[model samples]
Target: MKDGKAGAVTELKPSRPLDHADALRAHGSSLLLIEGNGKLDKVTVKGDQAEIDTIKDGLAEPVSVTAVGGTGWIAEGKLSYIIGDNKGKDPGPFTLTPVALPK
Candidate 1:
């Protein structure tokens, strides 16, 4: 939750704060995914913000993507092998057949 410039952290008031014209940026070690605005970006925030008080059931497995938000992913074999994106639900459960290795 610290904002810095050049090499020092500076405090700026809403009136004198730096321009947010670039973008609303935040960084943290962990993140959580939530639902909002009929989208999936509203429920995300930096870990330092809070204990990630999610109202929804939330994703099965949550992973932090650069301290931005929670992301979904499919993993297998104790996380040794994984495939596909799990951020969102799978409307249709597809199958992944293994290919025969070289004889």
Candidate 2:
């Protein structure tokens, strides 16, 4: 697989590491990973639990991504993101509303 070093991962800047959420976004064949759901737990990853907020207003499309409830958290795991020259139906420019998950 190609790493985010070759500009493949355009937008990836999470507070912590890239978890399942980000991994899913990377499916778009890009290195960027945007969180969709504001909640982190919503996106279930393999071998690790998600931890992030939710996408309140809407969401920004990463190359490909796996968001939780709504908030975008990087729980940890392997996922795929897709990024290419789409005609115009690109996702993103979304909300950054942080949320809290129930214990």
Candidate 3:
């Protein structure tokens, strides 16, 4: 991790098979969000083991994700948002929040 100090890169293995993860974002510490298989999953790492939890599900092929101030907006078949209580911690039950995608 290149937070500040230069050190050897440590590989974090996901608890479950990724299958086809297309997008990823890092949250505080070892928490991450992966977009794949029409869903968004939040992953956390402890030591060398990682765990995945579903944050959002049932979308049309989500491919990318971007976050700001601990809030993430996903681009599935459409660019919309799923609001959750995650702010660098706590994998949440995220819900969809509608937004107008640019035409």
TM-score of each: 0.19, 0.21, 0.57
| Candidate ranking (lDDT, best to worst) | 3, 2, 1
Q: Which stretches of candidate 1 lie over 4 Å from their true place?
A: 1-51, 64-80, 83-103
lDDT of 2 by residue, 36-93 (tens): 3322322323333333333332333322334365333433211122333443454433
> C-alpha displacement of 49 in model 1, angstroms?
6.5
Which has the greatest TM-score?
Answer: 3
Compared with the true structure, the alpha-carbon lDDT of candidate 2 equals: 0.35
Between prediction 1 and prediction 3, the one with superior lDDT is 3
For residues 1-102, could you state the per-residue lDDT of candidate 3 as single tens digits?
378889876687777777567766776654445455666677777876778777766665466766656566776533233343333554434444332222
lDDT of 3 at 55: 70
What TM-score does candidate 2 get on C-alpha atoms? 0.21
Candidate-wise lDDT, in order: 0.26, 0.35, 0.59
Pull out the clashing pairs in model 3: none
How do the candidates rank by TM-score, highest first?
3, 2, 1
